[model samples]
Target: MSQFNLTINQKKYDVDVDPQMPLLWVIRDIIGLTGTKYGCGIAQCGACTIHFDGKAMRSCVLPISNVGDAKITTIEGLSDDGSHPTQVAWKEMDVPQCGYCQAGQIMAAVDLINKKPNPSDEDIHRGMTNVCRCGTYNRIKSAIKLAAEGGKS
Candidate 1:
């Protein structure tokens, strides 16, 4: 077990884990943060998406060694009161059908809007590709629009 110190959700954590262990395990298992899900373990699914140094990344495939001093932000840390515009827009739109993937989806959407606050429908469709099996694409689009209009965030 290698010792590593990583910051998460604005808190510092020290863990003794295999250097090659994927960060998802460290976050969910060691650090006790489960908002970042483990959907496919492969990076294909966005269920484990989190912000690595304020940038969205697939945590399931991220090696602990690669994280270094980078900051980590999970769904819980997205907002102090869960009132981030995207979260509020998602609630206003009722976007989640099964709710299993909403966390990752919201995280990705926030990143998209951070880069482009006023994303067009096509831009949202192109930028946010985190899958939802319930296929609430239209609502997702609407929520993003609502968020862009200063409706939520």
Candidate 2:
């Protein structure tokens, strides 16, 4: 087992694990950060998405060794008070059904907004792609738009 220094969720961890092990396993199994869900072990699904130094990436396929000194943020660490405009907008607009993919979706959306605050519907549609079994696309789009518009805050 190799040791990797991971800065995650505002904490530093020296994890002793297989170097090739995915960051998802490190987060879920080793560190026990359950908010980053595992969907497809491959990179096809967005459920495993998280922020790597403010950029959204699929944790399921990212190796522990690849993390290096990058700051990793999950759904739990996105905002301290859960009042990030996106989070508030999500709740206000009621954007989840099964809620399985919302975390990744939110993480990605936050990245989008960080890069471009007032994204158009096409931009929103292109930027966020979290698959919901309940087909919450309309609500998700609305929440993202509302969040972009400040979530009624």
Candidate 3:
């Protein structure tokens, strides 16, 4: 086991773990942050999406040793009061059915908005590849548009 320092959601945590351990496990099991989910465990599914240095990344396949100094931001860190534009838009648009994939969806949406700011429908369709088995794509698209529009009523 080796000790590593991780800065997650602006909080710093030092942990002793195996180098081969995936960041997903570190975030969920070691650090005790369960907001990031486990889906395919292979990186095919975006269910474990999180921000690494402001870029959306799949945590399940990312080894903790590879994390280095990148700042990690999980869905829990998206907002202190759950008022992030994407979050507000999600609530206003009622984007989740089963809600299993919303966290990853929101995280991916945050990255999309940050990158595109005013993403077109095609841009959204191209950018958000997170799988939602509940098929809430319409609402997710609407929420992304709403968020891009600054979450206006």
Off by over 4 Å in 3: 151-153
Considering lDDT, where higher is better, how would the candidates rank from best to worst? Answer: 3, 1, 2
Native-referenced Cα lDDT, model 1: 0.89
TM-score of each: 0.95, 0.95, 0.97
Candidate 1's residue-wise lDDT over 1-153, tens digit each? 899999999999999999999999999999998888888888877989999988889999999988999999999998888789899999999998988988998889888888888899889989987888899989989988888889334
Better of 2 and 3 by lDDT: 3
lDDT per residue for candidate 3 within 1-153, as digits (tens), equals 999999999999999999999999999999998989999998887999999999999999999999999999999998889888899999999998999888999999999999998889999999999999999999999999999899331
Distance (Å) between predicted and true CA of 81, model 2? Answer: 3.5
> Model 2 clash pairs?
none
Which one wins on TM-score? 3
Backbone clash pairs for candidate 1 read: 85-152, 85-153
Q: Candidate 1 or 3, higher lDDT?
A: 3
lDDT of 2 by residue, 1-153 (tens): 997888898998888999999999999999999989999898877898999998999999999988889999999897788888889999998988889999988988888888778889899888887677788989988888888888332
lDDT of each: 0.89, 0.88, 0.93
Worst 10 residues of 3 by lDDT: 144-153
Question: Lowest summed-lDDT stretch of 10 residues in model 2?
Answer: 144-153
What shift in Å separates residue 148 of candidate 3 from its native position after superposition?
0.6
